[model samples]
Target: MSPSTSVLDMLSITPPGWGGVLITGAFATLFISFGAYLFGMTLGLFGALGKLSGIRPLQYALNLYTTIVRAVPELILIVSLYYAGTDGLNRILALADFGPIEVNGLVAAIAVLGFVQGAYMTEVLRGAILAIPVGQVEAAKAFGMRPGLRFRRIVLPALIPNALPGFANLWMSVIKDSALIAVVGYQELALAARVAASNTKQYMVFFLAAAALYLVITIVSNMLFSALEGYFRRGQRPVA
Candidate 1:
């Protein structure tokens, strides 16, 4: 077969063909990453708040959480969490007199990735919060604004502009880390490509295609974040 024809055959989408499966896996990767981002954002928000609180113990605990997560290798964390999470869930179910529940691939991916990303995000958010001038927070308090109101009106808006660049970088890192979840047998883009290569013995082609797809995702993400950063910077002059 001509090289072009061979390449086309490899990409065919019929049964026993991997094109459709690989495409689906790519979307699955995106979905899992987004799920992790949402979970991490929630954890990060509370974790940052805890670190900023007046209570010494809470601050120490939150700091400890961030330190442990940041220090661990992401792949090690994912693998350990996958097995441990499943075991913990089963134990909980057994205690409740329910049958053992299976941990699905997507669920495992989200759980592990979220916890890992949340640790980094905690630092990102905490730094952003600290970047806000003390006067701003004090001003809000002086107005007798409720805690929630102060956070919503004064703190959150200010923090967002400064936090966005760091958050955007972390978001990209989460997407890349999703590739590691393949070790847990999740059929994400990288895993699918590996399967296709193993079956067809076209390792270079399959992996190169997967790399292309990842590059596209990264480029698009960069563009989106750049736009966001520019939008946030509008009307503000750069400090010398």
Candidate 2:
């Protein structure tokens, strides 16, 4: 931008303006967060089940996994996992005489964030599963329902209400956590804002724009989660 360029011109969507860049970055942020959250939820499901499965070794392993992940700073985890994961994959490929391939940035970002998210999600789900009434499962068993059927019909439905709030929180967390991907050079909203600020020398303007985008995301997410919670809690008695 020239010295004479107005802030409005710099933010315009047309030529030489970075509004388009910022919007694209915002979409990228959403994509990464959504993908990571889904991946984490999948991992958390098996993790929660294993933790509760009465297998000593499995429980210990999961315990260690959750403990280490939760204890470490998220930024440290992101940097470590981001490099370690791709390097580990290349190492395995090298053993077979295969050429090392560059992992896609989007995939790495999702995997790293998802791995971190899985630990918290596991505990959230475990607690929700435990909150389910034991009598419901026993009653299903008495009616000759198989374990899988029992979980599907009884446990899942019951747990959703209990877990929805935690799920909402995790969703919010991952959206913000996606910003850490910028440290690794992937161009999410934060990175986009930084690039714009650096080039235009309007740090405050670009950063506040990015902050507004994040606030919009948070507000929309809250409305969506509220609806989801209402849907899941249908027919349930309100807590007195």
Candidate 3:
């Protein structure tokens, strides 16, 4: 088919515009990536705490996790995790005398991405935590504040501003990294675009459209983070 004809056919409203397919895929991509980010954030917060602990064993274990995860390429990590996760779950199910548990593409993508991103986010949050003034921590302790209360009230609030930028960047990376999940047959935006291109033989057009969608998501997320950073900074300003 001619380029114009192919484009028109793929985008025709009678079939419900390719726009809807693209949008649906984009939303799926965002949903899976964000779910991974939330999982990563939880892991990161605890990992950061572990790293910051005075206990040598806890710190050492966290250090190992960070080193091993960050040392490997994300694609390799994803593939390995996908196989291992599925196998492990199957093994557990069999042991429990349950039927085999199916690992969905989205679940695999989220698990692998979350695990990988959590490793890096640990360092990011730890650095932010360390950047906070020691004096403030000491003051909290001096005031007879318990460790938990001090962390929640004094340390966390101060660490957030510094950490927000890094977290936002990590979230963007998660979105981009999710593209690699296509290898595992995840029906994410990149996978959908690849299929569309192959079927329609308009590879460049479909791929370019996918790129534009990703760019839009990243740009919008960055703008929101920028506004948040500005708000936080304003509150940090010295009173006249």
Candidate 4:
């Protein structure tokens, strides 16, 4: 038996078919991270806008939201929210006379991710927005441009250059943090590794494979973000 064939046969013998489970787990991890990033972007945008509005009460509330979320450890938040979220939702459904429903770990993880990461993203976007020249915004307004038009034409274009790098960093963080979802029973890459190890009693093998898989993802993400940043920076000169 060839070495390659032996490896394949061993994988096939596993309950999840090592190849299938690992591949699926990778996708799941990516999907969870990506979905949460998108969600966080939306939440962060609102938070940034609220902060920038300069309303003292609103700013204080938004700041408090970010402060509490950022201070807490992500793993504790995920596990706590998973249990509390399930109970809270189920009770609401029961009260509504609807059938009880269970929240999937993936769903709970996404919520936790959005709550936590969105806080950080808010500051990133806020700083990006602040980096834009206030003079340009005033000039736009002076040009008879409406508030919406000024934002669409000047504000968005100006801040995007600053925001992209921050977004890339946030994206990478999300990918790594998705592993924590395993603690909540989301069965992502790390959880899959644990299961595969337990089933085959080949702890070293499965762990090494999981590590390789995560490394591949991180590498691919870095390359992708580099390409994106390059594309965005095509015509730009660096500031001194």
Top model number, TM-score: 2
lDDT of 1 by residue, 56-167 (tens): 9998888888999999999899999999999999999999999998888788889889998888889999999999999999999999999999999999988988899888
Order the numbered candidates by TM-score, best leading: 2, 1, 3, 4
- Predicted structure 1: lDDT: 0.90
Best-fitting candidate, scored by lDDT: 2
Q: What is the C-alpha RMSD of each candidate to the true structure, in Å?
A: 1.3, 1.7, 2.5, 2.4
Question: In candidate 2, where is summed lDDT lowest over 10 consecutive residues?
Answer: 1-10
List where candidate 4 sits over 4 angstroms from the true fold: 1-8, 11-17, 94-99
TM-score of 2: 0.96
Backbone clash pairs for candidate 1 read: none
Superposition error at 63 for model 2 (Å)? 0.4
lDDT of each: 0.90, 0.95, 0.89, 0.86
| Candidate 1: 10-residue stretch with minimal lDDT | 12-21
TM-score per model over all chains: 0.96, 0.96, 0.93, 0.90
| Each prediction's number of clashing residue pairs | 0, 0, 0, 0
Query: How many angstroms is residue 84 displaced in model 3 relative to the true structure, after the best TM-score fit?
Result: 0.4
Better lDDT candidate (1, 3): 1
Per-residue lDDT of model 2, residues 96-171, tens digit only? 9999999999999999999999999999999999999889888999999998998898999899999999999999
